[model samples]
Target: MSKYIPGNQKHLTLVDRIYIENELNRGTTFKDIAKFLCKDPTTISKEVKAHRLSDWYHKGTFYNAKNFCIHRYHCKKTNACGKIILCGVKCTSCPTCNQTCRDFEKERCSRLDKAPYVCNGCPKKINHCTIAHKYSYNARFSNRKYRELLSDSRSGVNLTKHELHKKDRIISPLIEQGQSPYQIVTNHPELELSVRTVYTYLDQGLFTARNVDLKRKVKFKPRKCHKTQISDRTVFINRTYQDFQTLHLESFTEMDTVHSSRDSKKTLLTFFFTKEKLFLAFLMNRCTEGAVRLIFDRLEKRLGTYGFISTFEHILTDRGTEFGDPEALETGANGIQRTSIYYCDPMRSGQKGGLEQAHTMLRMVLPKGTRFEFLTQWDVNLIVNHINSMPRESLGGRTPYSVALETLGEEVLNAFQLRPIAPDEVNLTPKLIRFNS
Candidate 1:
């Protein structure tokens, strides 16, 4: 058989070892067996020597000594012995001759030391062979031993108790201080742990901190999205997302409503400016079209005609009941077109993906199921300020408030009641909201 070249490195299978055993029993050379198995000859030689069984027995004992020899080839005095003239090689094989011969010594074949390392392929008959050494490979025993070693290798922790304690001491305080594992590892040069290991340790409860202590590790129920079918009366009929995209509006705002529990009537009206990534929040008594229109009117009144026109030239929003009245949201009280409103396709919130991503930060502060009934507009403003103050990597590490202040100017920000929090003061946790309260 031609040699089989493997394309990738892989572990030896039971079939390979069994093939080696069978070939050995058939008197095949290790070189030929290695060529057929696409392995090194030394690998085959080592395998037979490693797991081969050996046994010893007295003369006339019915013992299979194919691979067993207690003193085989070990003694050096056999050739120099005085009995060499009478006993010759048979003296070493005869068990009853001299229980203790001074010059008695055993010998191993040169073939065993060179290539195969076992007697499996030897042509010498086992019964007539002077050497009692034997080597036999068992596939079942080798495979079992391989599995046991593999399992043992993977069962223990890599870190010692002292090392674990040292890491726990450094990590626990940072976690308690609201620093993420990634942040801690990046900031501390002395900590030689990967972020994944820290998280794993926390998950396994090996540290003082637990998974629940990590804000992002806290699990929440996935938000259920009910697909709403559009009818002729649907506001989306006039201004579809495709129409809005065709206009190629560079600056636009994404609007969405964040509700509390079903038991509460209050909701947060979230607006995200795509260019600056500035997020704004308004607390509302209820999620109604009238309430949304009321906020729009208030914004128009505050920014006046031109400022409102510049700020909200185009608004993209999901097809929610709260934003059902596109006409009311688009038109002013005097019937002037203050802004244009476009609806994303049903169940396609990703069309306005910026606002959805911004909601994730909001979730960190006011998590889902939080009661918004007691929250006031001032509280919403504070949360929005903190969110806008966070440095966004996409914005070149500039805070949204800073970018908005530069792009929209101080007058527009003041009109919207948006203010920048200090870099260190900006917090995106519930604790900040509670502290402010």
Candidate 2:
């Protein structure tokens, strides 16, 4: 990119600067360089003169390189300090000579007065030219400064505080009252802002309503795409959501996994009962089909076969890869059917939305991207106890623990070791679980 074709773009690009630097080193005249770039010769001259930087590498190699006296060559004085006899060291080469010399004249570069101002085309090395100070132009440095100035050249906010406040007043209250950005913009035409813009305003902290207030938006990602090949597609045949709807079971549990981070292998398997609204989680070394099946086997052993069948008569979960093999979970080792397994439709996590909402409680303690490698099953149980004990308006001001105790029986609750946390002591913040320990 020696030169760009002449166009309406006025600003000098990085390529133009590089070309100018190379041309100056080859002693190319400013007029010829400007002719190739389709810019005025004076524009090129001003650019080089304004952005040249001083070369100061000598300070590291030579300790006494601070000498900037114009008469350093002819006037040779010794013992710049107050001494009767000469100290036998030339003042021109002394470290403190510049400070003591009363007639110290600052050196200036006369060559900078000519057409090409920078030292990029200088024939002498930097060490020889340091006496009078040398300056060079670099393409990367000049381009970076030009971009900073270009950004600053633009003006401040187009809207005033009053105007912004007016929009915020209309948008924030409705958003906090459970309305989406799309709904606000469509319902109130006076906003004159796009849904995406409203979301941006929220992100920038320009409004009172935050991203957390929009519960559904912050709880789940917009997309969950899995492009892996299905080794066995026949596993989803009769166990589809359609087949489960025919049974019309009065109560069921939704199953899902919570990832601590994408890169970490450790994960948590969660179970949310639809009727009792009780949440339970088990930490695993990794999220795998075999791990999930093993957890089911452990749960059956802990609850007894008959108790497990009564508690989990029918289970509905998403089509996650870890939940791929359902037969291992449904059939016990003694060849008895414990519980039926069903899968939600593809891309439909909302089918078991009761569990999806419960995931938020988990995220409050362990946000996305948190490392779960150090956590234990006891830590998971502690988190579940606090979550199930919190009072909810949907449950008529009663906690999930109280409901589970009566509905699922006290013996099952005792086996699970579920307890109630005081209403005032219910801490849902990230401080509840310390990952550092």
Candidate 3:
């Protein structure tokens, strides 16, 4: 036998069961076997009783002669046998005799009724015993049964239909009202369903609403490639993306132009602060170099030379024709360097990726193919304000407006007309802009 270690109360292994079977076959007592195995005597006793198999004959008679006699209560001569008067003659255990004994009756072993429930480790000879009752342990059978039970236990949800329906009632309405699962759980304290579970249920069509109804579930078209327009007369020679990286500057702004399918000439010039995630939008009459220059000049006049230089110390943009006039963008009204402008490599708009990602939020409110011809600078400002007010996970749940207010101060937010909206009221849908109009 292996040495027993204390405090090792884990589930039995096949090796342990094999050892137990060997001890039983050797006629070892349950207590002695348990002591050697470092398990309680009752655990050994229960293990035998729970796993032991039984064989039954016709009319539910156990195959054992003792059990068979115990089930023969309908036998005819009740008091004729002399043995009946003395002790008991439940049955004629003779194999030649037919089952015609008048006082036949079965008996149960008293030892099995107490402890060590099975016949395992019995000292009696099997051939001498009339009772066919036997107990033996098989390691392979026990291990297979254990694995099957474990798998069955881990297979299903424990929620009742009533509980699931209750959760669905609370969640379905919020989803249909255009609230994201994340927003619903965050806003409602009583909802017990997790955001992931809600999404899973939505995907499974368990809810009344589908994923297509969700605002953010809409698909966007892939970005098209624009041909690179390299020019010798352009001022990009000194202000390449390589030049921008060499400066090791902490703060810079990414600029891009957003066009509408309804009007070719009207567009929105957008600027994003990479570090703070602050975004500003200016409505332009056309997607032209002169229109972009006019917006920059107006911002310089509004912020003054010092404020403009401090805020827009470096501007990184793609090689759009509207931003092709890098010289005009770099020079102030006094013919001096207002701020440096750097151009990304041809066909690599991802070089200014911050603005590209920020544009997704803008596109949520003003989707592509929407007419921007009727929109004004104030209307664009309103849309940008709401976009900036949304909490970003990357910002530790702080809105861009909040971060900019702290980093760039109230003066900058006032200059851009950016204002913070209540967290719950920060809408990112076209309905908001339409309602404002």
Measured against the true structure, the TM-scores of the candidates, in listed sequence, are 0.48, 0.49, 0.48
lDDT of every model, 2 decimals: 0.79, 0.83, 0.76
lDDT of candidate 3? 0.76
**Candidate 1 lDDT, 138-160, residue by residue in tens:** 77787788789889999766889
Which residue window of length 10 is worst by lDDT in model 2? 1-10
- The TM-score between candidate 1 and the true structure equals 0.48
Tens-digit lDDT track for model 3 on 181-280? 9998888767677888777778777777788878886575545766535355457777888988999987799998888885457999999998899999
Lowest summed lDDT over 10 consecutive residues: which window, candidate 1?
A: 60-69
Stretches off by above 4 angstroms in model 2 are 1-224, 228-231
Clashing pairs in 3: 69-105, 69-106, 70-105, 70-106, 90-104, 90-105
* lDDT of model 3 at position 92: 39
Worst 10 residues of 3 by lDDT: 55-64
In model 2, residue pairs whose N, Cα or C atoms come closer than 3 Å (at least 3 residues apart or on different chains), thus clashing, are: none
Query: Which regions of candidate 1 deviate over 4 angstroms?
Result: 1-234
In model 1, state the lDDT of residue 44. 74
